[model samples]
Every structure is written in structure tokens, then in C-alpha cells.
Target: MITDDLIVKMTEFNAGDPKRIQHFIKVYEFAHVIGAKEGLDENTLRILDIASVMHDIGIRPSEEKYGRCDGKLQEREGPAYAREMLAMFSDVTETEIDRVCFLIAHHHTYENVEGLDYRILLEADFLVNAMEDELKKDAIITFRDKVFRTKTGLHLINTMFGLCSI
Candidate 1:
């Protein structure tokens, strides 16, 4: 229920920006699927759900401040917004908030990914981004090799991109 509330709040936060709203929704769906398929526990899956929805909360701020919302800028500005928005929900624990903020901050960083939630967040965001960005097959393959770890994520990418083995 909190996740549902968060989704509504995030949607409202990005009102009139269908592109961003759709982007986060897609990422949230991908994260939910990947997290479920990867056997994440309920709490972890909830964290992933929250993080995926709030991951791009920095885009508007970054655009207003710098006229662009690059990954680094999103990483830099996202956690504060995430914290503020997450604070509205009394049910969300402090630990959950910290982890969600951590995911928001590093969703773009692929190196030395530590937690399952982090790994799934990267893969889910990439799955949506690859399509949204119209990345070439070679680039998708490169990212697939370098970033994908979960079997479900690999399968989704390979199948989505027509790279899966027969």
C-alpha cells in the first residue's frame, strides 16, 4: 500500500511530464519483474519497488538548475529529493529509506555493484533505457555482457534484442 501511495505521489510529482512518468513506471515494472524472478525477499522487493519509482526524481531539479539531467547530475541530486518524498510515509522505515536513497544515488554506476537490489535496479533501468535510447545492437550486447547478472535480466535483454541463442 505504501508503494502504491508512493507511485501516486511520484506520478503527481512528475505531472505533465508523461515521458518521465512513463519512464519511471516502466523501470518500476522491470524492477518488480526482475526482483520477483530473482527470488528477492518481500522487504528487498519493496525496496526495489520504491527505488525504481523514485530513481529519476532528480531529473526535474537537474534540468532546472543546469538545463540538463545527465546520469551524474541525477546521482548527485536524486537522494535528497528521494529522502524528502519518502519522509511523507510514516510506514517506511529509516533503513528502507537509506537503502532506497543509496539505490537512487548509484543506479547509474555499474562498477562494483554490491547488493542484489542494486544489481536488479541497474538491469531494470537499463532494460527500459536501452529501448528508450534506441541503443544499437552492439551497444546492447556490450551492456548485456558487462552489466547483466540475473538470469531473468539476461534472458529479457537477449530476447528483447533478438540476441538469444536458438
Candidate 2:
């Protein structure tokens, strides 16, 4: 129920900005699919769901402050916004909030990914970004080989991009 509530909040937060609303929605779908396929436990799946939606929460703030929102700025600004939004729900515990914030802060960080949730988040975001950015086949392939770890994620990227498996 918190996930649903958070979705509404995020939708409202990004009001008049369909691009961001749709971006988060797409990321959430990919995260859900990749998380399920990767067999995440219930708690982790819940965290992944929340993190996926709130991953870019800082974009607005970053843009407002800096006139541009890059990955590092988003990572820096996202956790506070995520925390504020998460505070609205009593159901989300501190532990959960901490992990969700951590995920948001590191969503764009690629090196030494630890948890399944983190890895899946990266894969899901990359999947959406690759299409949204209209990246070339070679770039997709490079990311697929270098970044994607889960079989489902790799398959989706390869299939979506029409890249033959290496």
C-alpha cells in the first residue's frame, strides 16, 4: 500500500512533467520485472519498488539549484527528497527508509554494486535510459556486456535493442 501511495505522491511531485513521471513509471516496471525474475525477497522487492520510483526525486531540486541535474547531483539531492516523501508513510520503517535512500543515492553509481536490489535498479534504469537516450547498438552492447548481470536484464536489453548475444 505504501508503494501505491508513494506512486501517487511521486506522480503529484512531478506534476506537469510527464517526461519524469513516465520515466519513473518505466523504471518501476523494469525494476519489478527484473526483481521478480531475479527472485528478490518480499522486503527487498518492496525497497526496490520504492527506490525505483524515487530514484530521480532530486532532479527537480537539482535543476532548480544548479540549472542542471547530472548523476552526481541527483545522487546528492535525491535522498533528502526521498526521506521527506517517505516520512509521509508510517508503514515505512527507518531501516527501509535508509536502504531506499541508499539505493537512490547510489542508483547512478556503477562500480562495486552490492545488493540484488541495487543491481536490479541499475539494470532497470539503464534499460529505460538506453531507449530514452536513443543510444546506439554498440553502446547498448557495451553496457550489456559491462553492466548487466541478471539473465533477465541481459535478455531484455538484448531483445529490446535487437542485439545478438555475444
Candidate 3:
């Protein structure tokens, strides 16, 4: 039930700067592309995309409070905003909200990718991040087998970044 409107609102809320806003949008786009390739159900795909857009909601406050934006603050501050904003979407249940919030809460950590939905979003975010971080040199061999968890994600990353497939 989560709509594109909700995703936009959360992205705007979480992203204070143009770069941050753009980052979330890119992550969401990556998520959507992967969802199509992975054949995720509509509802599940909505949650994944919404979660991807809202993933860094805590970064703003994290920077303010700790003078740095990092995983601990995301785990600490992200879910609360996700819970509050997600309330507007009637189709989004508490359980779905909690799951999305949980992913946002733990996004920077790689320990929680056991689930396919989360794994897909995580890899999508990493694909975008690796590009943003200019980690292009190792886009293939170094992380060819490491960061990518899906065939679709690997394809997108390799193709878009101009890296030869592994």
C-alpha cells in the first residue's frame, strides 16, 4: 500500500542536501530495477523501495547529534522517523512499517541480509554507494562476488559502471 508519495515525503524528510536526496532516489531506482528482475510481489516491492528511500533518514540527526553520520545513529534514530511518516500510508501496516524501519535501522551493517528483500535493497544501495564513493576500480574483481547478492544487481552494476562482467 505504500505509494510513491510516501517515498517522496520520506526522501525529502531524510535528505537535507541535494546530494543526500539524490542518493536516496538512486537507491530507490536501483531497488525498483532489482524488484523487477527478482519478480518481487507488488506489496513486497513497495516496502523494499520505500525502505530504500528512507534508509538514511537517521543521517541528518546523526550528523547533528554526534557530529558524524554513521550506522549506530541510523540504528538509533531512523526507525522513529520511519514509524511516524509511514503512518500516512493506510496500506502500510505496523508490521510492514516495522520491517522497513528495521532495515533502515540496520542498513549500514551487513549482518542482516539473510532475507531476500533486504538483501536486494542492501545490494542496490551498495551499488549506488560504490558509485558515489568512487570505488569504481574494484567494481568487478574485488567485489564481483562479495557485495553483489543478486544476478540482476550484478548486471546493473557492471553495465551501468562500464565494468566487464565477472
Best by lDDT: 2
Ranking the candidates on TM-score from highest down gives 2, 1, 3
lDDT of 2 at 32: 98
Task: Write down the TM-score for model 3.
Answer: 0.88
Residue runs of model 1 more than 4 Å from their true location after superposition: none
Question: Which 10 successive residues of model 1 have the least lDDT summed?
Answer: 157-166
Compared with the true structure, the alpha-carbon lDDT of candidate 2 equals 0.93
For candidate 2, lDDT tens digit of each residue in 1-166?
A: 7778888999999889999999999999999999998899999999999999999999999999999999999999999999998998988999999999999999889999999999999999999999999999899888888889998998898898889976
Models sorted by lDDT, best on top: 2, 1, 3
Model 1 pairs in collision: none
lDDT over C-alpha atoms for residue 43 of model 2 = 96
For TM-score, the strongest prediction is 2
Q: Per-residue lDDT tens digits of candidate 1, residues 25-119?
A: 99999999999999999999999999999999989999999999999999999999999998899999999999999999998899999999999
Superposed Cα deviation of residue 1, candidate 1 (Å): 1.1
Prediction RMSDs, each to the true structure: 1.2, 0.7, 2.0
lDDT of 1 at 34: 93
For model 2, what is the alpha-carbon lDDT of residue 31? 96
Model 1 C-alpha RMSD vs. true structure (Å) is: 1.2
Weakest ten-residue segment in model 2 by summed lDDT: 1-10
How much is the lDDT of residue 71 in candidate 2? Answer: 98
* Candidate 1 similarity to native, TM-score: 0.97
Model 3 per-residue lDDT tens digits across residues 34-133: 9878999977887788888888888887888889977787778988878888887787788889889878877877764667678887788878788788
